[model samples]
Target chain A: MAVSVLTQKKNMPAGNPVERLLAATADDMARVNSLILSRAESHVDMVPELARYLIDSGGKRLRPMLTVAAAQLFGGGAGNAVNFAAAVEFMHNATLLHDDVVDESDMRRGKPAARMVWGNKASILVGDFLLGQAFMMMVETGDIGSLGVLSAASAVMAEGEVFQLAKTGDLATTEADYAEVIRAKTAVLFEAACEVGAMSGGADAAGRAALARYGLELGNAFQLVDDALDYGGQSGALGKNVGDDLREGKMTLPVILALAAGNEAEKAIIASALGKADASDLEVSQVVAIFNRHDTLNRTLEKADAHARTAVEALGILPESEMKTILADVVMHSVRRAS
Target chain B: MAVSVLTQKKNMPAGNPVERLLAATADDMARVNSLILSRAESHVDMVPELARYLIDSGGKRLRPMLTVAAAQLFGGGAGNAVNFAAAVEFMHNATLLHDDVVDESDMRRGKPAARMVWGNKASILVGDFLLGQAFMMMVETGDIGSLGVLSAASAVMAEGEVFQLAKTGDLATTEADYAEVIRAKTAVLFEAACEVGAMSGGADAAGRAALARYGLELGNAFQLVDDALDYGGQSGALGKNVGDDLREGKMTLPVILALAAGNEAEKAIIASALGKADASDLEVSQVVAIFNRHDTLNRTLEKADAHARTAVEALGILPESEMKTILADVVMHSVRRAS
Candidate 1:
């Protein structure tokens, strides 16, 4: 299995390599955190209440950390990186809030989703508020190139979500469709975050392009690992309800692979469980058993490893530095989460 | 009633003044229309489907027209005004989609609300897509000042909606509180629309300030009339289900005024209907009876008249032209909708 292979090859600190990247960007990240908190404020009570509920909730701030780390890699100081990072975080949280409403998800980051506490209407409006604040932060930077990148990402992410919604419950969904879904919904933002960070860091055309490729490949690997984790990882480690993707009928890579490889009887088992909110634990285990028989989860992990390798390769254009090493490790750590 | 006063004064052509404003800015507005439709395109089927449902609906493009007209006022040629106008329209429609979800509205522009057709999830996501596109359009203009104005308006609009939600069914809501709600929820966007249009048109500091004031006052007047109409005007004319505000328990000015002046017996009747989804026509008429007895609807029109006059006065700084005169007429037309 790819997980066993991944585990045997890795020898690093117990903590996530992502954590190391965070430490390298700690000071800039602190400023980003402060700006995030301060900008969430509003005279209208619910704006801050709902915003803080999501922002202060324990997200690793990985996307924004990537933003800051990417900037630092190019020797960018605490210039527009702080604002861009904060804006990226806001965009991520905003999507989370809306996605919860769309998915009817009750749990997020091991806590009740904002929609659960505040109602769908509040969640939706506050999400809009966060996005507005995000754009406001970008505008204040007067960096038109960064603004375009982020805004385009925002549009693509929405399209990705809609496409996923359309494909839900469809067993015939192709890997190409799955790839497009992840690319638009997940990888595009990562690409934009790193690209904008590069732009703010005074990256030339080549450096900026390299960072964008790095972010996209890393994002693809991260999503693949996450999809596999939904089937195999601990719920506590994942910080979400187990079998959520299966329950929601998401056409992730592992499920698609399993479906493609399975016999008729095995397909029937997954069909019954897919999109069933009340699908029993026994049903999920049944599906997992089938996945194991086909080695689909490992195959998914193998694909993730391929993307992660490409992500590391993307960093070759940049001069070697401690930050670059950490970034590369972060890519590996994302895929290793399933290990 | 203020309607009588408005109709008697200096009658312009029988044509709708909004149509006149449209004619004055036809070229730029046509461009804005094309940009709006083009930007709504996405590979995701639902994105364009829901977006077109709202954008192609029969509602007059008043906000974007204000943007184009403001540009024309400064003799602006083909410039960023087209992009800003399209951006303003997208922002307006984005709010409409979300508002339908928040208000549980089934009707908009004399048709089923997008939420009703595509479900609330699609509506929310597509609304988000539009806002993203709006920001992209603004970024493409490379006008950071205009971008800041539009984004700030977006934040205020969300805050306003939340404020209104909090005040829903609040019996003791004050006139000032009601004013604040509309100012944030409605007027700020109008102000931003004209302000950005003026900025794109290369208006001087005084000219920009004047357009901002004009837009703010016009928006205030327009909303006041609309709120009053919720109690008195035809649903067909409004392109909304009559009594929608009452059904949603929106703390509109007429309702607030009636509540303040209402005796306990009348207050009881209003409360019974406020926020009641099943509130019958009989109950609505009962609330209308209370409003008419207090002259509250007339009082709302009078307030609107005051704002409309200020709107015209705000335009006094501009050199008189056919466009300027038509713009002033448009202000009057908005208030006189009740007549």
Candidate 2:
């Protein structure tokens, strides 16, 4: 429900979905933000030098905000929910540092990636330091239930990353296999972040499960939209280059769905596009054209909408709150992103 | 003292220092061996395949053996100690994985290094996985006390690795800094393994403290020997090329001592050799000649011996037992190893 949480809070206009979502989650995030900043700042020597480059570089803080918003939505804030909200951001940033190293990426949010500026070793170690810090922060919460959830999520996230590496450039990847990897790599953390939020929020088992399902669906939708945008999202808004994933030989949901139902010629073009890790813009355009011709974008969007609808439906059991409406809107916010 | 902790009691032979020490520690090691083997077997996926590979290559399992030996010496059992021992090996292997990446070396323990075989990303993540696994195993103990000791030791080890990386190729390195780094990097794990063993065995604080001190001194002596061998040990026997550390531009205690005492001419040679990471044996030999001329080798041995003696001295208060004697002889057994 904390849609564009950081964006909404930092620069709110008189009225908009971004402002409404940010305004809705403002009180909860204020508490978590203070702790998040302090927790991150505690490792100043390890994180500050390059972290400011990334953090101050301006990320959405979407995941952590989801954590705090989820907690507040559940009407429970007496526990360590705020601390955990901050902890999730630490974990996310840690993975980002390591990912930049693995991807050999040079830019993040228009600034130099940690590896490009501080070297790969620093990126790797600082990433590690953040991971350790996240673990330490979670342990301080003294919530054994949340601890188990977070650790398992951490392991699953690593497994997903490994699986993705092994499957790169393999055109025969199944939707099921790719979805499983995506669940592990992306959804697990999001799902667990929400689950932990609910758990710390004093939600019952059913409530927690509902929130977890919602998070999983949201994550799927987010990644699907991301893939669709990769070939055409505005360079200035999305923060990632179009065609980067395809160039890296990755087949996202749109590409997967497109190739599955497309004609032979379309499949051939798709295969060729993913073959080169540094494919030209012309190749990217051809693939995008095929996507449009085959209606893969609409198909993929339907699948994403199904997930988002399911997420909102899962929240039917919860008592109505302004936060729930915000959460409901997040589904479309990501799917309808301009950039 | 439960010298024969795992298998045949008669395997606890007592004669010459080296053979006797080996025999005395062999039973406990048998238990640790199986646990490490089984843990590696459970994860054979291509992602962590390098982790299994590096582990299966088998570098004597010395660190885990130290844990086992310490447990038995402190009257801890074979069964309960196995996981702790496994934890020690996990940590050691984790360090090796990271170290190989840092050194960019192509070989480890007579096999292709993790970085060489699986690339830097795999090596780094697997290293992180092993560290996480170590903590997972520690958590099984359900003893927060054990968690505290292990986490603190783990952090120290990480700090040491960072310090070593920072000091790489620095000719002006001092012995104190060298000791600090090793203490964090290697000695703390060994020391913690022993102290935690005593703690698990229900030993009083005084007893655990004494054992930890003993392990600390022994580890220092052991690494000093390792440092010594890096400069002077045979290639095949050492399971690493001679001057391997020097090839990584490492400044060991012998080099530090020699550089400190040698005239301007010898100091210049040391700097020149470090400039060449692949410096030949003849080049290393010239540096060795300088060390011999300055008598730094003897000084290094004398320094190692002092630590060994201190390790032995710390055990004076322990009750008389065969395990005690074997543990005491670790000083001599450690420093005497040619490689």
Candidate 3:
């Protein structure tokens, strides 16, 4: 089962760490996909219609892949990882459906948001439906321990959201606040996914803690890159327009950093554009110019690189397997996107 | 424990079964209430704000009370009925939050709906938060069987809402369809409440089955009476405006029965008013007149009476106790409200 370090290095490509993870876990991924589709089915047509719309939408399903991959690495009979993987995917999608409604977002993943087609009410109810299905999947595994982990993550995620909503446009929102927000809203789920994956895979306490830390740091790196991309990356790459975070008054790291460092006039331009919802592209460019002058976007990416390094470091405690190597590479690739 | 039938009858008052049941489970109900309020707390202020708004809005807490009463009826140890009871209340309040948003309701329990005060987005997110908290409470109980039952009920309830939405204005919605809707939307939760209560109370299989049947039939009767009251009883007694269901285009049994028996003109009146969201009082009375012509209100009450009788019959298997008598009387009172 041991591969030479040279072979491992050659097999790890700079591009498509996510794709590599998915391929490594492809067999389990197929089972997870089938479980997801079957559970999304309901006697109510709209339940399936709206659910399938979001589930079938083209996305990497990176979260579930992480789950399956983490389980594969530990190799503990793959006990209910399929169910847990599907549960993780549903949880992630449920948040997306709710997020679009909360942000009044019109587009997701190069397609119209589920809220846009079915309206907000349906989106909300269907999001609840998906969440219910997620719990059902967790229960079916009969792993009460994993159920506790996932359920706690769900609450933390909601609190993170409400916290973000409260701080949406606050100019004085600090870096520490941003860290708390991302930790709860994004990284906690990732940590739970990996931790539960390890639990089902028969990992010892140290192995579980290592994966948890890996997922958390990787999630932080992922979101930081996403925030920087909102200001500097292509809309095609982002799956939305550039500067959406600014338009929505999201106090992302780049904005928080730029605001803290900007002169009086630069601060004025950002304050005017942020949270406007209809802030023109010209206004976005002005904000971007300010971000450039302050070097906040690159600084945000720099922070992402630091976290990605920590994420890779987290994986060092685990035994060297191809899955572990791919997972570490995936963390690096996420931050490399911004670079 | 072996009280005579006559003694049971003498102790049970026909006038206030729900109140009697509440009194019977007062201590457990108090713990459930405290747990509910404590669990509703969050670092995110909006969550507690919106959650408390709905949780404290004068709900009867009948579902949670049933959980407590069912648990207390058996002399089994009260393992975690407090947690299950609070979980049931949270689940009920969660539905109310989402229901207000879906129904576009401006008022609930004689006050402005949460959505009306805080907007639909907050209502939806807070509802999700409460559901998360509900599952967390369930996991704390460490009862996987009961968790499966409640989680299945959650999914079925969401399906019920979506099913009800699908049939909102469809004239072809049959009596069978109406039964399915109510069973999923309302009765399933009741069944789960009693079943889990029995589980927590350390009931044997037969005892659990009996309570489950009791709750299902009582919930059916409760919903049927509420439907009849929408057309025939006082709006003050019902909490919302009379004919609110008709305005929302809910195809309750009374409306379905009237439509089945009425003339084409009557059919037209019912159809036009079904989903208008602003159907006038005169139009409501006209529909009521059609219902009277067919004696549909009386017929709906008859259906409720039949369900209530079944609910009482379900309790016959249990040992004669004050709690059992009060539970039976509560079912009778629910139907008596329509009478």
Candidate topping TM-score: 1
After the best TM-score superposition of candidate 2, give how far the Cα of residue A113 lies from its true spot, in angstroms.
Answer: 1.2
Write one digit per residue (lDDT tens) for candidate 1, span B1-339: 634335555757668888888788888888888998899998888888899989999879999999888888898885998999899899999999999999988889888999999998888888888998999999899899999999999988998998888889998889999999999999999999999989988899999999999999999988999898887642223233667788899989888988989999999999999999888887888888888788888888888888888888999888888888888888888987875
* DockQ of each model vs. true complex: 0.81, 0.30, 0.67
Write out the backbone clash pairs for model 2: A1-A326, A1-A327
Clashing residue pairs in all predictions, respectively, total: 0, 2, 0
Question: A1-339 in candidate 2: lDDT tens per residue?
Answer: 124222433432334555676677678778867776665553225455665566657787788778877887778873588778777887788778877777667778777797888777767766665666666677677665676677667667766776777777787778987788778778888898888888877789899999999889888877766666666642212234777888887767767877888889888988987858777887887887777776666666666666777777888899877778777677657766733
Give the DockQ of candidate 1.
0.81
Q: Per-residue lDDT of B138-210 in model 3, one digit per residue for the tens?
A: 9999999999999999988888887888888889999999999999889999999998998888889999999
- The local lDDT score (0 to 100) that residue B196 gets in candidate 1 is 93
Evaluating just chain A, the predictions reach TM-scores of 0.95, 0.89, 0.94
Candidate 1 runs further than 4 Å off? A2-15, A234-240, B2-11, B233-240
Cα lDDT of model 1 by residue, A228-330, tens digit: 8988742213233668899999988878988999999999999999999888777888888888888888888888888888888898888978888888888
* Cα shift from native, residue A324, model 1 (Å): 0.5
- The residue pairs found clashing in candidate 3 are none
- Candidate 3 lDDT over A193-247, as tens digits, reads 9989988888899999999999999898888888888887422232339878889
Superior candidate under TM-score, 2 versus 3: 3
Lowest-lDDT window of 10 residues in candidate 1 chain B? B233-242
